[model samples]
Target: MTFNIHQDYSEDTGIRHSKYSETSGEDFYHDKLNEIFYGCYTRNEVLELVLDGGDDGYTPSFLDESIGNLVYDFTLDVVKTMLHIVSDWEPYWIDEIEKKTYPKWEERRRKGEQATITKSHGAWYRLINGVPEKRVWIVYTEEQ
Candidate 1:
């Protein structure tokens, strides 16, 4: 089964930005750490479901064994510690265009000039704030 993980950020202006990632149930269970971070599932929820043999309809039955094994391999404290190591993550561009791109985009928007912005290339994972994150660069162009 495919699961969509979404992250949202809200600005002071009340505008919200959302980012999403799609992962298979197998991959999701394998990673485990992101279960809580991505808000897909919480460690407590997994533990309760597996231990109590209860179903909330969120976790797929096929992943039960994998989730059980993951719980068995590590204690809750250990999982918490591991999660702390990588507190959060964000998308980033591999080309590292933030410095140049943001200023130009802001200037264009400020001046009410016509412009086009695009992003391409595979997201490269990197470390930021002691967390592993995917990076995506921007391609900016002026409208003719």
Candidate 2:
């Protein structure tokens, strides 16, 4: 839905401000779309809203940025979920152990000694429903 920027903003002034007054056309929607994006929803729900070929909340200007962030977050969540599934119970213990044993394990491996790495067992779950732990992903590219 288009936001009515012309609505009365200040009672004392009775002045209606246009969103265009502050930012360019593109940026105005970017800000608005980002506002809706911060709400808690499953990755799938957000993706469906943005890309499932529907008019439901799909604003033209902010489409690219919102879609990009949504895709990145969804991919991260999927990977995290898969890792948790593969590890089964180990993810739980790994999440809890308040220690970084990676260095020691690497040292042992470098010394030609087989080191048993300990991983915690547990499922990966969101602390708050619908919010991802982090919004970061790595892209690996190969040179031809």
Tens-digit per-residue lDDT, 1-144, candidate 1:
122222211111111111122232323433442334323232223222111111222222223322322232333333333322111132221012223333443454346452222212233232243344554422333331
lDDT of 2 by residue, 2-40 (tens): 222222111111111222233322233233323333332
Model 2 C-alpha RMSD vs. true structure (Å) is 20.2
In Å, residue 47's CA in model 1 sits off its true spot by: 12
Model 2 regions lying over 4 Å from their true place: 1-29, 42-62, 72-144
Question: Which numbered prediction scores highest in lDDT against the true structure?
Answer: 1
Candidate lDDT (C-alpha), each: 0.28, 0.27
Candidate 1 residue-pair clash tally: 6
* lDDT at 27, model 2: 35
**TM-score for each of the candidates:** 0.20, 0.21
Task: Give the best candidate by TM-score.
Answer: 2
lDDT of 2 at 102: 30
RMSD of each: 18.4, 20.2
